[model samples]
Target: MTRRSASTGRWTGSSRCCPLKTRPVCRSQNPRSSNEPLAQGSPASCTAAVPGRERKSRQAGRPDVTKLLVLGAGGQVGWELVRSLQPLGEVVACDRRRADLSEPATLGALVADVKPAVVVNAAAYTAVDRAEQEFDLAQTVNGVAPGILAQAARSAGALFVHYSTDYVFDGSGHEPRKESAPVAPVNAYGRSKRAGEERVAAAGGDWLVLRTSWVYAARGQNFVRTMLRLAAERESLRVVDDQVGAPTSARLIADASAQLIRQALDERSRGSFGSELLHLCAAGETSWHGFAAAILEGWRELAGADSLKLRELAAIPTRDYPTPAARPLNSRLDCTRLEERYDLRLPDWRAGLMLVLAELARKD
Candidate 1:
């Protein structure tokens, strides 16, 4: 498929090359409007910007050890980022309380005040089903806020890193979607996220948008948590079998973000850093039923003979379980661009799932 550059209005096919970065792009090229009302959140209460010491640190050619700002420090990926980003710099982590994406205007101000050398936006409006009802709020938070953050990063001369979803695709074919593939989001949430991607690209900054799928963590309310809770309370469980994607762990995503951030910082030192979108998810794919089964089997082994009363597991089609929002049947993503550029590759889904199971067992 031919990849069109939203920045340069040029086309490139199948090559690992980037479009020429001439100047800051305009707003009309972006389909999403930034004038939407902000999502619900208070303005930033940070009085002083980042300390002067950090500014000096940037000039001394040691920006890696400078201030690294991360938005959404409370979610699964955000929680892991606190620890993962420490190696790169003095991690100034902000949850919704500190830096809320819903309050879009505040984000730009907060970013400007903080003046971070690197900005990683892990925060997003991820309520897939609820997004159908709150389309405006979702678009405001997921779409406009990212563009605000990206522009702030540009003004502060910081590299922007954002996360996206496989939902950007319609999920028609069994093959993994590449970065160059045409996007056709089926649900409101997907449309909002895709809008965020466009806005970020149009902002014309040094940015990296990592698109992942089926994300879960040891903490937070994810698929694994839901399955475990249901298994303990019910006699059986029914999971959809038609949908397929890699179950990417939050820890893995955090680690990969750190790696990519480090590389971006290193490139900046050489007076150059380019922006590109890439896929970053666990290797291989499986249906939701298969993922649930693996989680249960792993938990059973860890619990010895005293496992949950999960007597039976049933696989159902997507049509059998209607939801407020439609889910893509295929969430698989091709990560060749990521692997080739960063010399990085994720481990298989099973390996990461085992680690998560082990962590959960330890907590118990």
Candidate 2:
């Protein structure tokens, strides 16, 4: 798979594409467009045809019928959502160019124009360190934009699906943070996201705010890809050992989201769509250092690349490699609420990591 780095803004290659859940082709927002279109690098047609599955679903008396409007259809989660949500309905995927979150005022008009039955927003100002200096821009995109989307969804009587971060917490306490835990963001990015979550709740009709942590993807720039790239280049790596959280896969997140959406659709008449916030993440936890070591170990075992130049990987504290913005020491999030509500549980972080590493090895 290929990924564009979010931190360095560089392109890197390593793994195969994530497993796709196929479905029938749907009408596109722009029929004559590529997945990576120009015009300010906006997202192109995000729909992909899977005639086999579509026919099967129809035969089963459950037709693919919903109209899904996906924002940030080019990002990690958004990209996977395009594939996973296809079986559910017609997907109109738009990238930043089509549904720019920074332009909050224009979002309402865009959502209204689409008038989709379901609106899933997977975009945000994700540059954590950069956000410290660009707080205004971050607030506009991460805070104001969600409310606009939520309002639009409410007006259209659509189910609003949003992804949030674990940064909403201040990283205090040793135990996993629950959905009812008090929020105390210690950084600009966290603050902005928390604001967005609140706004969504206030503006919501049927909505779900899914909070996740340490999100990685087989195709996107994430911790897994970063670790692999670094190991290839450097002989030694020093990673933070203090901060801990599950390194969740974007693929897993997208699949879980689709499942939750299906459940919501089926139980809407039973008042299952009441405004709710749930933590959706991989099981177990580890520090950045532990995660890196696991990635390397998985690669070595799966790829048989023990001849790599990398020799040592040292564990360091957060203070040793400080960034502009502060990070939570404890990023662990309790997924009990999500499990109870959706009747699903995520795989452990190590399991997901192994799958990604295997994909990477196969691609190489």
Name the regions of candidate 2 deviating beyond 4 angstroms: 1-64
Deviation in angstroms for 99 in model 2?
A: 1.2
lDDT of each: 0.74, 0.72
Best-matching candidate per lDDT: 1
Task: List the candidates' TM-scores in order.
Answer: 0.85, 0.84
Worst ten-residue run, lDDT, model 1?
11-20
Per-residue lDDT for 358 in model 2?
76
Residue pairs with backbone atoms closer than 3 Å in model 2 (clashes): 1-15, 1-16
Predicted candidate 1 versus true structure: per-residue lDDT over 1-364, tens digit per residue:
0111211011000001100011111111111232433233333443222232333354553353477788766667877877887776677767665676766888887777666788888877765666788888778778898999999998888899999989899999899999999999998888988999999999997999999888777776567776777788777767778888988888888888888888898898777778999999888899988998899999999986467987888888878777667888888999888877877766889989999999999998
Off by over 4 Å in 1: 1-65
The TM-score of candidate 1 is 0.85
